[model samples]
Target: MTDIKATVFIPTYYGEDNLDELFTALSTQKVGFEYEILVIDTSSKDRTPEIIKSWEPKFKHFRYETITKPEFSHGRVRQQAAEKARGEYVVYLTQDATPAHDRWLYEIIQPLERFPQVVGVMGKQDPRTTALPLLKEEIIRTFKQFGPDFGTTLFYEDDFIDSQQLFDLVTFYSDVNSAARKSVLLGDVPYQDIPYAEDQKFGEDLIRHGYMKAYAPRANVWHTNEIKLRDYKKRMFDEIVGVRRVGKTMDPISILFVIKQVIRAVTLGSLFILKDHQYTWKRKLYWLALNPLFVIEKWKGVRAAIAVDLDDEQTIVKQSLESNEAIAHGKQ
Candidate 1:
């Protein structure tokens, strides 16, 4: 028997239904070297662990562990998973999202092996077919507003880049699909308080550590969570608040930032109306083009996420990286 050099990380929270699909997809991963599968379950009340129990018989290298205590937050759970990892590179994934490409796992780890300076690699995030139209439209809209004309999709083929540019790609620290070395994280680099800011803060920390964050276009995944304009705005607001909380709790920032971002939003949002009018109008048009169907479904999704007991499961507003359902149904 030989040891695998890489580990695939799945941070699951009541993802039994979703895990089945992702596990099936993972089976086809290109095998250059041996690999280990680490399923980090965050103590879901759902049947997710039971699902893993059944898979255990089928997979030799498959391992599963749960965080029995619900007191912890998302970042804490992620840190727990990172601690459990024993591979050269760890692949972080949302339990619901699926890898669109088989080479996704390989492409993400390749940079670290090839370049010692590359500390992390992030993949391109595309909407899966299973994603509802409202989700699809709203996601595209969010990306557009987050970084207009940056392209509808965030995949790029660059080997080396500065931290600021990497931050720009992330649209101000949203860690949707990303990977990093296990050695860099396990010991002292404590993650932020919540699940949300961990990725952004890490990329920033790596930047501070004098390492390069690489972006891989080929390594792609589909993340699903569809919301409409109102929902998108709420998500954005949550995002802004999260960042501000991190700033206040971890390290205090000057009044200059508050003043700067407010000005940027007011100015840039209006500029979006002018030079970037096409992007803004299309988003508006998508809202209008889809009519009530788009609006209702998105509103439903937003409400679904809100209505769900957060402790029980991720907001029903879940989207898949490989969502065939959304594509077929045309609803979120």
Candidate 2:
């Protein structure tokens, strides 16, 4: 076998729907480096395992293992896979997120190769066509988070205003589509034992350790899911848990700042929809009505998260906790 330059680590559960297209896209990557894929699956009852076996003949370097659901921790599982990887660079991707194009793998790993100081890099996300209007807007906003400078943008601890700002920046990155140097990821800053947002925790370690991180927009991936109010709230709770587990705290003062942001975002988005020539007034009105709901949902999420952080059990309100647990276990 050729020497592996990069390893793509994916954690999956009931991902039968996207497996075929995902493997096909991975096979088409236009790169000079030899790459391998390592998948750690939570024992799925569906045809997910069968499909993976079927694709083995097609991908010479593909390998996977099965683990029970109880054994799964977002960070720990991926870390387990990374420990087994032999590549110099480790790339993380969710099973459902397909590469936007063949160049995605090539583009994402380029930053790590170009800058020795850049320990990690993240790519842009494009929502699926089946996504709801609210989700589509969110996907656009996430893609635009890096700004116009598509080129490599480095982030350091000093760039932030305060510890909270630094924590927010570090913990906001998603591992859904990202890459890191193997040495740094395994040696100096290994993945933690967080239940969610382990990617952000890794980012925290990077900045604290004085290593740089980069945003590489040229690398694109398709990733999104339509979410109801409860789902959003549940995610917020998990996000808070992740942040606290990594020794970061959200400031009580930032609550006001977040509220201000919500108003500004709602107002600007509503005005844009109203002024756009392509949208009919009825459509404009509908969006205006829905946009505030989105803002309110986010505000609710933050508040619930704060409550979880402050509570003795480190849990959200009891009523909401039951709902979030159901959603987490696929009971809903």
Candidate 3:
């Protein structure tokens, strides 16, 4: 079994109900070859640790470890996990997601067995049944976010700044699903400099640094969650800020670009409130009529992105706590 080495890494925090189901699905799969499981946890205040411990027997190869730094977001934390991983290949999946089929693991890892140049393979993310809207919306957001680099050139090109097809890059990447050869990721924690944007940075860096990225759609997974519209807008703003945070290290124009995007986002979101989604007579009328508030609200998300600083972790922590609680209350 040592001949074909592979490992699955699940980095988690606050994955309560979803983690249990994901592990259960993993336990039933027929992975006869030598493989290992690594779960890097950030001091979870939820039931994630207990769930992983319960599956120790079912997943005999699973190794669970925790890191307590609150400053590192999930993506950075994931890079930290990869540093400690011993497998020749690393398959990454979010706890809220589960493999869609039994052959998922096989399909994801097979590329490396056949092609030595393939440094990484990230799977397609398809929502189960009623969740297709989330997928579609995410596609739209990614298409807009990534601009022209969607599908054409293997890597983002400065020459094609307005290319619209590059949305495929986002489609190919899901924090919920991905795999990579350890050789490509070793000592690559430089991508983890922000509160988020690790996956985008990781893929971009791999391509820039001489590794090739692969998209194997057959290795699919079903994600059980979606960001609400408000949350989605906020998360994007946060990611934009994360990008700017990193960009400042490389170029200030990048930060200016983020500011431009935030301004554009405010305009785009306002238009949506006024023109898109026929939610209801009352909602449509109210939101459209009160476009100023909608614009203001979304802009707040953009500002929040600029406000986060590594040295001021507590300040960001307080805001994150408030935002999370607001979302919970809204859902309730």
Candidate 4:
């Protein structure tokens, strides 16, 4: 058997609709070395299993396992996948994050293959065309901070003065499109059993332990969640709460702060919408007018997240979209 160079690990729940495109893209990857696809399904009631079965014959090695929804944990399942991987590296992708090009797989694992010191590599994200203007803009802005879209940037522990400095610059590591060394994952920097921001925490852990993390901008994925207007606040709240669990916190909310945030969000969002060429003038005008409402809801969510006590499960359950989903369907 050809030795597997990497394992592409995806943890899915009700991802039947996305599997076909993801697998089709994977099949076309230009990776010169051998790799395997491993999927762990959280007992999805949809056609997820059937989809996986259909794709089994397309790859030399394909593995799938099913676990009850209640048994799924973002960090625990990923750590288990790393342990089970037959490759030197493990590349992670959420079901909806499809590779943007044939070179994605090769590029993402390139750093791990070349730089023995790089414990992890994060790929760039290009928001799907269906993503909202604000969401697309956020994705672009976030990735731009790392470096040029076609360049490679590396982060090292020796460059930062303190953990705060490290967190400020490099804590954005995302498993949505990322690769890491299996040995490091299994050894000093296993994913923690946390509900949110496990990827960021893992990156932080690796850097703190004197290891390096790389950002490969050429390795990109089309990823986004189409959040409804009504659900926007809940999503933001869930995100803030999740980051808090991973040791990142927001300042306490005040009326003055809320006012300032609202003004900032509206002004910046309006300008972004007006400047974006993707939308038509009519659509831009519409979004420009509606931007204030979304911005208001966003600040409301931020305020609620900052004010709520994390230990209060009841409050968290009420405010968090993820908590509600987990409670309702036993999946995160």
Best by lDDT: 4
Per-candidate Cα lDDT values, in order, are 0.58, 0.75, 0.61, 0.86
Instruction: Select the stronger candidate by TM-score from 1 and 2.
Output: 2
Which stretches of candidate 1 lie above 4 Å from their native place? 130-175, 187-190, 226-237, 248-332
lDDT tens digits, residues 1-332, model 3? 35546778887766777887788778766665767788887667678788888887786577888766444475666666667667778788888789988878877887677777666676766554433232433544543443232221123334444533443353234456878877767754234544555676676666555556666666778774545545544654555555555442322234456555446545664455445443455664554444444334445655665656645755554555334643453421
How close to the true structure is residue 209 of candidate 1, measured as C-alpha lDDT?
Answer: 63
> Counting only residues 3 or more apart in sequence or on different chains, how many pairs clash (N, Cα, C under 3 Å) in candidate 3?
7
lDDT by residue (130-163, candidate 2, tens digit) is 5444566667876586655357677767754466
- Higher-TM-score candidate of 1 and 4: 4
Q: What is residue 110's positional error in candidate 4, in angstroms?
A: 1.0
Off by over 4 Å in 3: 1-4, 69-72, 132-136, 139-173, 187-193, 227-233, 248-332
Candidate 4: C-alpha lDDT: 0.86
Q: Candidate 3 or 4, higher lDDT?
A: 4
* Ordered list by lDDT, greatest first: 4, 2, 3, 1
TM-score of each: 0.64, 0.82, 0.68, 0.92
